[model samples]
Target chain A: MSELTLKANIDRPDDFYADLLAAHEGLPKAQSDALNARLILVLANQVGDREVLKDALAAAKQAMHRDPARS
Target chain B: MTKIFETPLYPYERSADQDAAEPVRHPVVVIGAGPIGLAAAIDLARHDVPVVILDENDKVSWGSRAICFAKRPLEILDRLGCGQEMVDKGVQWNLGKVFFGDRKVYDFNLLPEEGHHRPAFINLQQYYFEEYLVNRARALEAEGKPIDLRGGSKVTAVEAKDDGVLLTVETPDGPYRIAADWVIACDGAGSPVRSMMGLDFVGRVFEDNFLIADVVMEAGFPTERWFWFDPPFNKGQSALLHKQPDNVWRIDLQLGWDIDKEKEKKPENVIPRLKAMLGEDAKFELEWVSIYTFQCRRMEKFRHGRVIFAGDAAHQVSPFGARGANSGLQDTDNLIWKLKLVMEGKAPETLLDSYDAERVHAADENILNSSRSTDFITPKSDQSRIFRDAVLDLAEHFEFARPIVNSGRLSVPATYDGSPLNGPDVAGMPDRTRPGAPAVDAPIGNGWLLSRLGDRFQLMTIDADAPDRIDVEGIEVERLELSTNDDPSGALAERYLGDAQAGIYLMRPDQHVAARWTKFNEAELRSAVNTATGALSNRVETPD
Candidate 1:
């Protein structure tokens, strides 16, 4: 019973994906990992709600372990 | 191609003061004849104050510098009597486009509201700006207004005393001494006057260099500000493009720290960069080239006993926001009025402290904004760069992220909120005309509101009753009566009165709101004026 918005919010996900990939180009593995870490922190700060962040963490952890072939 | 800079506009001449045995004393002596000094002298002379200006150079600045002039400064120039010519010759535009990588993320219009007289901004060379100011000074001098512009007169030393300051000025002939009751230092960032008095600015120095190339070209690009972040040509740096008058385009390319400063300025190295930005077939001629690294810093206080500092001498900001000259103009706009009042003995000397307070507040705001823009352009760390790129990436399609992208918040007049000079504010009136805010311009009949308010203390009444004039302890406060019917467009009422039916406002000479009320009250009005002119120490007491 949280007020966090969990839905397909992005209008054009493909364009955003391309931009994200382009931003990570010409970087080493360590730098790219650093970038992802920074990006997560930035987006988390933008979200700002502790309840929403907790929900997002739980959802992302669950997605990491789900079976791809069965789903 | 000889330009205005080559001709000596105010060359060295022998003066009578040099031969006198005793040092000649003047009412006010201004150091540095740049935009700020010239403006201060002109404003003082316009008010019948005798002033003198000293500068090392005899002509306008050499190259096209400080291209962007904001509307507020243009309005200030109007009060100085040179705004129309500047607006006529300047390339006016309000649209600005921002690009990330190669694709444009968003664009913005600075001034969307109508009924204002001046445009949002104009791009003109610094040389032309100084030329226009010098012309105005000459006109004032011809009419026997007390203003002396002494070229090639450089101050070698300064000494402050209990009541005045003595300046040792080195000229082509020899050194001469002059004393003034007050000295204004409009000398730039490396201020000799400040150094002589052992004063320093405390702030940050941005560790990046930008290459400025003013090129003459015939191109069809629209007159708008175009800013790029990590363009393909630059490949990890920011760039800025602006169009100036006389077919000259100003281009700024960010170069990382620890680069060869002199070798990059060579035409051989600069031409290839231009070719890469503009295709090989495109033709252009380089007019001037320079590299600059900026510092965001300001003095602890602008007023130091008898010697006062204005403009770059008091504060310095990065060039991203075009706040340098624009803020300097506002500095003179804020200082001259207070100084005039104090010199006339109508107000106590404490009035000058408000200048230091107000302009220092403005300097901090400018520094904060320009520093943020610099950080966004050149991220200090890899993590910061990642977050910056993330903001840019999300900004391409998302509406919420656009506000986070900072491509230099353009210069606007500072509202002296909580300033010592601010008087009082009513609850129900519009916030735009609140205490300490500059009067919002509105079309009143055939003229503008700002034109009628400034130059003296004013009592502006809109659909309210007030006297024709009031004398506040020998200072005259004229009344400007207006109604919604005066402005057929209704902008005046909308801007001045929101939920209220009528309003009365007390305005300072600088046209900032000193106080406002829903109805006319003489006692409260007198108290507000006293507070604004630094005549009263306590807060305004409202009578029950």
Candidate 2:
């Protein structure tokens, strides 16, 4: 029932990652953290489905506690 | 200058009922002369029901409270015969600008479309609003209407009986006992009648204070709402500015919790805050200053036997959205007509319960919206503030984030989506005029749609044939036939019919759509009329 694409879905993964980091360049930690929060909110609105958002939140939380070495 | 609040508009006078041998029983006794109570009395009296309004004070309120009047309440006032005067004297505005720090964010319009009779909102002092209502009441009384406005008469005690309510009203002379077949308590937030009945509101109490200052000044500021968030003047707080009639402006500054309210309200202390918001060189005189901390709460139920609660007596909400008086006006507008029907025995007594259900639904909506606005304005935790500030920060750059910004989701009429009294809703019709929604105003001929709909049950037909009148049991449903050609602007069909070719709409006395069908069906129309009047036995089917 979940429509969230948890797997890699971007066309250019490295370029997208580089752009995300570049957007936060020349900014302090607080400013970068605020920008991240704002980006999440803006994207959540774009992904307006509540069910998808909920699944994405759970998946994100699960990854935070997962053992990185298992990957 | 002598203000209107200083004059006794309805000073106390000994009534004939007070001197009677037995407690005189009236049809209805309203327990306050505030705007809500007065409007209720006027509405009941307009229906030929004898009504009495008892209040402790003789004049309008002392301060400029509840300054913003929304369009729905303005339309309700039109039904009560004072809308024109309010619009004439009040400052009409629809544009609002939101600010963050010293920078201006996007400005929005409350009413973007046209063809509606009333403006989106008007700014008028509560005193002037009450004075206009009082004048209407006096006019009705002069025309030999069955209405009484007794000032300085305080209702000290209330006993709700199976048949009626016994009230002890203390007047200028002495206390007297009076009884009414039904009682409407509109005595405001700290309702004495509610206390006498051992009732209490249940909800959240916000922990913040707002200082409201009404000042008289000559300024070049346009008639638009200006709201500031964390400006240089008021650091880390929100502020609102609105222009009212008579060169007077209302300013609200968010003073964080744990401040001395008395010291904050002092003119010497308040003038500096005003000078900072309005430049230091601006000249102004303080008219009124008060500190208010609000709660979002309401009674568990609005009705209990012969005693019913309306206005702030029934529910209370934070003032951020101007929902206090606006919703109260709506409460009475939804109630009085149903009370009239029940009193006349044309509708079942169960109809009163729908008032409880529908208005409690509206109250919950108002509470939810105003509470959200309060939370946004005064974020509780550090995380919430971060998110709030992020939205404001992003709003300056992106249009998507602007909608996330919640200054106050200003008051709009509540749509009773799942009200028990709602009838049927056919598919393919516009949702704006769906069942249980208030009738949208559209230009018809030279007049407006709402002006012709309220005051009684009407069967409105748009390019659909219907009988002139239909009487279900004892209630009469008159017909209002219209064609799309009548409105050259094409607003009527666009609002009432989307893709449907023709429509037949059943409207209640409150001008809410009870049911709509694509074509005329006699049995369905009859059943819908029965259901709308709370005649449970005639209900053929339940609405999904």
Candidate 3:
């Protein structure tokens, strides 16, 4: 998924995601997506809660739906 | 025996006793007395490990260098018990401003609230930073800890012996050799130690050169990073201004390859550039001016034979993002535990190679990202510059262009993949942790987020009610009640969470998550813990 989309999907503090998106600016789509995926997996695993993981997945999917490349 | 003249083993060579020196042997020999190297020495000495540090220079530099330290390094300084002193001496800036021409385009509030332990970034001169480190080392030495500072001694030859490294040093009087159990080279970019080992410093060098001037100013410039694209003074160039702690403002001018670097930085020529940008009415005294060429290079292997590399000796990133010294400090942080473990005989020497592999990966990733950032900020070719300008222009009017304009990737931590530490994600669950980003708060037990900030390996299990279900090794597990009925604020109960109750989270010493798991089905977590703790694969596992 695109970094911007992946960030929006996760339930992190708004400022956190905003800061992340800001940093991801000017990056290629593939790079953005790879970084997004890496973050999601690591965080979901770190949080160690299936519920949070589900939330992240749903959010990621919804975010993907809003963007063509990510979908 | 007394009448016979003593002869050295290398009959033609000099012995290690020309100058008046102590006969004490150090367990570790750390080359380079920079902040990171000093931090490592102080840490090892405090931990009761004999450490000897050597620096080529007689003393630290007086000028301000490496003006920024990120949260991670500050946290490390905190662990070394000097974080508060650094905070007191350094300027903490939580906001960064970006300008497109004279118009300010982007601004970020690094830490909107004050509850977090650390702000986004701290600005301090490298010299003062080293001063604090030297003081700490001296204090430790005074307290009977064997932290030796051999100033003016430069390592000229490093030969790997069966037991340890035979380090050859050039003293003012003559040459001397010491057999160190292990060696850590933190010498800056022109690392003689790294070169001696024949390690490759691989990366691309940018054509752009910076004419940096540190000046004491009476102007009321805000203490924030201000970047100007197509600045008025140099239309095709870039300018950045930041206020230092001593009321000095650092100005950087991007002079493309065509300009004569040496002549451009001369006071007479540089003064006019400063005047045109800051206005003729502004009064400021120039502290120092120098031309710097930015490049991104990382050593392919941080460890060779019996020696290891840290700091700029291992890798260097473009200064645009302030990742150079920061990354070096992180390298020391990563290597400290392994060094201690190997020295204490708790783990085998083979574990040392992981330090090289893991840190090399981190350095390479940082190098690429920083280089990409430099490319975005200062494009070389006309086409790329046009593209950059077009994006910045589109950002002004188009709602869709905001993300592109405000990309926050520069501050995002470099992520680690290809790491054997990461657990497999079979559930196809969406990942939330960005590469190199900090771990998010989650309920693993009766856990308070910010309180667990220091060096400890935390293992969280899925059986929140009964965390004893999984028998993990070499880590402390904090069981969080992921039950929806128990702690409603549990990670499962979050508005963002859908279905998660049983899993595992492995946290590193720095509180950064190292790996995660759902069940103890595979031996991955156990092995990862072993790896993190410097245990050999065949070594007896720590009892659960």
Candidate 4:
């Protein structure tokens, strides 16, 4: 059981969504993917405590894996 | 006597030409009486060009807008005869301290090199800077070269021409019209002249709004700049503190994009923010408070046939790095010299094209730095914030990470890296002061090297005598005899004569390096000047 928490953290989701899209605007598909990869590693480092990073990683992998609701 | 820091307003007077029956024509007309416009007038007067400046307002800046004056602008002011006065009245500082929460990340130094006339930067309000320039312009006016500075005169209409510009101006008394051989728009970021032409001024707009408040307090704060990412009082946003003259402290707080700007500017709302940074019991009165949002924008082209744009009128940047005024003064510096030559029929009309080329490059550089600093301080995404925080945290431990921390990289002079005016880099050339770079100051005998090399083409030959009867017109040879150890500090030798023993160099009137060679010849120097003045080509290299 990963101790990762997903909550409503954003104050305004609409503006955040627009900004996220703006960041990826001029970038090519491959470059956008590279930016996402770098962004993940940076976030992992700030999650500083390795246990928290592992927990976040497990939660992210679970999201990407076969649908949990369907399973 | 209570110390009065408020700026005195100058009364607008009726110009002698207001009653003229015919439209009075001038060599040049400068709009807006800010630092850029006054500099244009003063620089033109120094070159014996008659100029007239118009400003709608009679007073200087209300607050301490553009508090930091960089070294390059200081040098330009020094040439205009107000540099020393500004330095005498302003507080000089070079060190800046950056912090993450309660811990100091790193302290950095600017202008490490010595023997220069001006310091790295000075903290003075925009009012004082404008006063000095206005006084200098008046002094020039008394000496036969008249700079007619008209306040309370607003330009209502501007029509283009094949050779000149027709300006319809409205004064306090009545409406009048004037014509100029050329018109320069220095009317600030909300430039009316640019808008009259229906030009699109567009760029990236940062969503973050900053609350800048100036407080008059007697607390013993150091003169150096202090910037904190997330201090104890402020939870997540960044803050900055800097000391100005007259016990005034400038505090900049990052108010998130969602705050009410009108309510935040009220004294009731601003006092608490100041208390949070200073103390609960801090005895301070708010002198000024304003909320500002920055945009990094510029016109598509600075030159519009007979009309031209400069300073904030042409381009703008975020105020975080103090690039606004510094780069604007650079625009006047680059424009006036070329305009003088062109008006005098000495240089071709194409010389003005280089002003557009060089300053647009400079504007882009400032915008890039300012935009990046804004992103670093106010990261949009959590991932972006994570990287910023990681840099802030790692900066405390790793020396390599310290350079990556960005808290408004202080303004430095722009280098025209690949300018067409640049000549070939000859043997034994120096690095920073290379071709297309502004000349650096060093000690030469009793005075500084830059003082001797004013508004004329200078040929400084180190350790070697200048050749006699050099046939290139307008080129003045200045022979520097720095015989090995004569320059005890080796500052002159290092800047002019490279390590490989290169001695001869050619400099443009604006003090940019044109060409350099060990051997002196007339033909090569002439060709270099032709290139420097845009004589060889008509178009500047546009970015692809």
Q: Which candidate wins on TM-score?
A: 2
User: Which parts of model 3 have CA positions greater than 4 angstroms off?
Assistant: A1-71, B1-25, B111-115, B405-412, B423-505, B517-528, B534-544
How many angstroms is residue B327 displaced in model 1 relative to the true structure, after the best TM-score fit?
Answer: 0.8
Name the better of 3 and 4 by lDDT: 4
Q: List the candidates' TM-scores in order.
A: 0.90, 0.96, 0.75, 0.86
Q: Write the per-residue lDDT of candidate 2 for residues B1-544, one digit (tens) a residue.
A: 6899899999989899888999999999999888899989988888879998999999999889989999899999999899999999999898899999999987988764788999888999999999999999999999999999999999998989999999999987999999999999999999989999999788898888999999999998999999998889999999999999999999999999999988898888999999999999999999999999889999999999999999999999999889999999999999998899899988888899999999999999999999999889889987788888899988988988998899999999999999988888988899899999999999999899988988998999999999999887778999999999889998998999899999899998888899999888878888888888888764444443
Candidate 3 DockQ category? incorrect
Q: Please provide, for model 3 over A15-57, each residue's C-alpha lDDT reduced to its tens digit, 9 standing for 90 to 100.
A: 8878898868999975565455445444544566666667766
Candidate order (DockQ):
2, 1, 4, 3
Q: Which digits, one per residue and each the tens of the lDDT, describe model 3 over residues B133-225? A: 777887888899878788767789888777788787887656777778888898988899877877789778888788889888888777787
Q: Summarize candidate 1's per-residue lDDT along B1-544 as a digit string, tens digits.
A: 6888788999988789999899999999999888999999999999989999999889988888899999889888888899999999999887889898889998877765899998888999999999999999999999999999999999998999978999999999989999999999999999999999999888998999999999999988788889999998787999998999998999999988899999999999988888887778769999999999999999999999888999999999999789999999999999988898888898888889999999999999999999998998899997778778877877787776777788887898899999887877878788888998888899999999888878899999999999999887878989999998999998998899998899899988887899999889988888888888898655445577
Provide fnat values for all models in the order shown: 0.06, 0.59, 0.00, 0.00
True contacts kept of 2: 0.59
Once fitted onto the true fold, the runs of candidate 4 whose alpha carbons sit more than 4 angstroms away are A1-71, B1-9, B468-486, B537-544
Worst 10 residues of 3 chain B by lDDT: B2-11
TM-score of chain A of 2: 0.85
RMSD of each: 5.8, 2.9, 12.4, 9.5
The number of the candidate with the highest DockQ is 2
Every prediction's TM-score for the first chain?
0.83, 0.85, 0.50, 0.72
DockQ of 2: 0.61
Give every collision pair in model 1: none
